[model samples]
Target: MQKQSKKGFTLVEIMIVVVIIGLLAAMAIPAFQKVRAASQKSAITNNLRQLASAADQYFLEYGIETITSAKLADADVGYLKAFKAVATESYPTDIESGTDIEATDVPTAVSADNTLTIDF
Candidate 1:
């Protein structure tokens, strides 16, 4: 009589594979989350820089230091309309003004005296 070999994976082998997969996932998830947070921060910083540039242009053209409200007003449009419009479209869910902007972990430096500070 001839001896037959098993064609399927052994229980121990399967369990080991599952454990390894689980360990890999556990190690990767947190790193992925950190990467996501960093990406969001970068986007926010870029948006802020764009906003500051627009504010500067607005000030240069209209002689205003800060945007009137968190919302860009009509007078403020000429300075940052292009950039703001693009950012508004790209980050639709996160788009906000004033306090909401501050809530996104984006550092802000607007002065109490109404002067806008450009800081990233």
Candidate 2:
């Protein structure tokens, strides 16, 4: 009589496949998180730019110098009207932005320098 081999994978083979999959998943997860963080940073920087632009336009249109952050949320003539920059995640200020944005860079860019810089 001839001996017969198993048709399915052995226990060792199955465990090896599982470990490989887990390792692949572990490596892939961090990469995904890094990408997500980068995208978020880009988004926050863009928001800052838009907010600054809106303030510039508002000043140009109305000659207002002390434009408050709250004004940026106005839907009537605000640049960030659609975005609603007031909704901050961590801070109680006009915006949290989830980034280390320089407060000075905003107004200076809008009024003095007229240059938008994404202070990341």
Per-model CA lDDT versus the true structure:
0.49, 0.54
Q: Highest TM-score: give the candidate number.
A: 2
- What residue runs in model 1 are displaced by over 4 Å at the alpha carbon? 1-3, 66-120
- Give the distance in Å from residue 110's predicted Cα in candidate 2 to where it truly belongs: 24
TM-score of each: 0.58, 0.62
Task: Provide C-alpha RMSD values for all models, in order.
Answer: 8.2, 8.8
lDDT of 1 by residue, 1-120 (tens): 999987999999999999999999999998996776566555655665666555555556766544542344345454444334212223223222332223132322212332223342
Residue 40's lDDT within candidate 1 is: 51
Lowest summed lDDT over 10 consecutive residues: which window, candidate 2? 84-93
Candidate 2 local lDDT, 8-83, one digit each (tens)? 9989999999999999999999899667655644554566666666666766777756465566676765466545
Question: By lDDT, who's the top model here?
Answer: 2
Residue 35's lDDT within candidate 1 is 71
The C-alpha stretches of model 2 lying farther than 4 A from their native spots are 1-6, 84-120
Checking candidate 1 for backbone clashes, the offending pairs are: none
Instruction: Give the number of colliding residue pairs in candidate 1.
Output: 0
